[model samples]
Target: MSMTSDIYKTIAKKSPESLFKDRGSKFIGQAHPVKEEAEIERILTELKNKHSKASHICYAWQLGKNYEHYRANDDGEPNNSAGLPIYGQLQSFEVTQILVTVIRYYGGTNLGVGGLIQAYKTAAQLALESANIKTKVITEALQIDFEYALLHTVMRIIKEEQISVTSQKMELSCSITLAIRKKDLNSIKKRFDAVFGLTVITENF
Candidate 1:
């Protein structure tokens, strides 16, 4: 995705589990696509339960189309050694709306902080590399209201603009919600505003 574009890159689904070994320690990494902060804890809990014997579970996640919200957790590892390294990989891959977790199982030996960073970074990178990355357009919803008599005109404009109608209520009066690509919002809104008796309301998503 281009830096100035309304498109963003994200994982399409949960990635296959990946593993990295360093000295005697084991690091297992997995990446998941997430939309809300609430989903993060649930995923962590499931991983904890699945890896009950593991020593630590470090993770990092980026959310929003603009990558506005994010978090990193060391989960008991040395500060900056585990979570930050994992997060760096997310930045390196230029992906958002994703969570990458590295589960560690102590193998009876201590990898120094440097070693731990390398191990976690490699694990996270491996997980992301195995993921199905996809580019998605950022969109906004527009609520359009018009009279039934003008349905054909409104529908014609929608078709011409290739806009997707997400929901609609057609009666003597008509109300429809459209999902508009963020980049085309201004031009599309202008077109609808020019039509007499039509109302357009912008809804950010």
Candidate 2:
């Protein structure tokens, strides 16, 4: 399967708990920051090359929805052996916007289905915990403009009110753009009215 979901999150940087190493295989799990598809490809390539001799490399990433929104790849392992287990571990932790690559240095034996599942699950679990990440729901483009005299005031208000002012550059007027949270749109509008009276609101972006 493939990941096409749209959830946003960061990776954790801590490892997991348990002596859950089922031998026969050595696993190294790594968590990565991937904000775009190209970056994801880059990371996968780097890891694949790094552990070129690993028996199998399975990975998964959670985007947003379900279906293929959850993506997993078996690499060169048995079908459903590598990726699905990793995907399950991610889902178990409710972590999104994360990429996990599990490199397996195979022992001279086959882990069968059960053994393979445990090994993969353990690797994914460890990698995810180590990532230690955070994320917030973000929206794009809210333009708040005012005369130059009030630019500082606007910026101050935005900061004090916990609004994220994303941009503050433009000509003639002191222009500001904030990454307005979906829930705070109305509140921002009201404050805009209170402070800047003639504030303009546009959904052009």
Candidate 3:
């Protein structure tokens, strides 16, 4: 699929895990759906505390439905041996808004750089394979404001456009927060703009 396409794929939820072993070394892989950058640290902290004895914790994450933001960390493993391999799986699946972490317990025998890369890649793949994935379309959050007199017209447009309203405040004035799928954003914006004396503002959630 085109990287700039309106639709994308991502894990439906967090908590999928997989395990891999090589030369007595253990690698535990986990996949999580992340909504924001700060969430990455929260997840890593929990995993590190839980696996206090692990020799290394490596991970990769892609943020944004379009897979625009990403990161990979090797956590002291040989350069490129652990993190890049894990990131390769995420890219291969063409998925985003997710994070994958692999925790390794060292075996007495050292697996050379190639071996480490393979093990990490395989572990990440297995974790992703175990996840329930879903397709998502690009969407933008919008806030609409209008006087009470225009409520009926606004509601009609909302229904016709099939916008997902997140919150609404209807006092003397009306304010609504909703999400507009990318495909419908322009058309919806035009329709709302035509409403007399109404105001529409777009923002990211």
Candidate 4:
């Protein structure tokens, strides 16, 4: 699909980590896919707890297909030395919905501001490169309910449109949750709306 056609780039299924050392300081960087700010906080908390003795924990993250939200934190490093460089690496890779955290262990030597920037940048780059990166379609979840008689029609539209059914419940009345690519969602919704007995119960982005 074209770049503008309902698609986004994100890390594959797994997170990756890397380590870098400059002078005597050790930098450990890890990359993880975060679908929400809550996940970001949780991951950061976990990392901080895991490396509680580290000198600093710095991070950068971008969210949304359009990169609607992003932040970088130096974590006591000299100004932009730790975070901005890490964020720049993410931009270079063109990946969103990801967070990268770098933990430092002060190895009894201070790698000046420039040295810190390079070390963090290189560490984040290594983590990202070691990760499995992939592109995915931007999708929205939709919950649909319909009478049993309209099941055939609904299923046919879903098949023709290639919508992924995330969950379903079949009974006297039926319900199905679908993951529909953003570009195809409106068209598919219109199709289901035309069927009198079909009802769209909830839509989640």
Query: Which model scores highest in lDDT?
Result: 1
Runs with alpha carbons beyond 4 Å of true place in candidate 1: 1-4
Q: Rate the local accuracy (lDDT) of all candidates.
A: 0.93, 0.69, 0.90, 0.87
Question: Could you tell which candidate, 1 or 2, scores higher by TM-score?
Answer: 1
Candidate 1 Cα deviation (angstroms), residue 137: 0.7
Q: Write the per-residue lDDT of candidate 1 for residues 1-205, one digit (tens) a residue.
A: 3557898999878999998998788899999999998899899999999999999999999998988788999999999999999999999998999999999999988888989999999999999999999988999999999999989989998999999999999999999999999999999999999999998999987
lDDT, model 3, position 171: 95
Off by over 4 Å in 3: 1-3
Q: Residue 61 error for model 4, in Å?
A: 2.1
Ranking by lDDT: 1, 3, 4, 2
TM-score of 1: 0.93
What shift in Å separates residue 19 of candidate 4 from its native position after superposition?
Answer: 1.7
Number of the predicted model whose TM-score against the real structure is largest: 1
Question: Residues 60-117, candidate 3, lDDT per residue (tens digit)?
Answer: 9999877789999999999999999999999898889999999999998999999999
Q: Going through the candidates in order, what is the number of backbone clashes in each?
A: 0, 20, 0, 0
Q: In angstroms, how far off is 96's CA in candidate 4?
A: 2.8
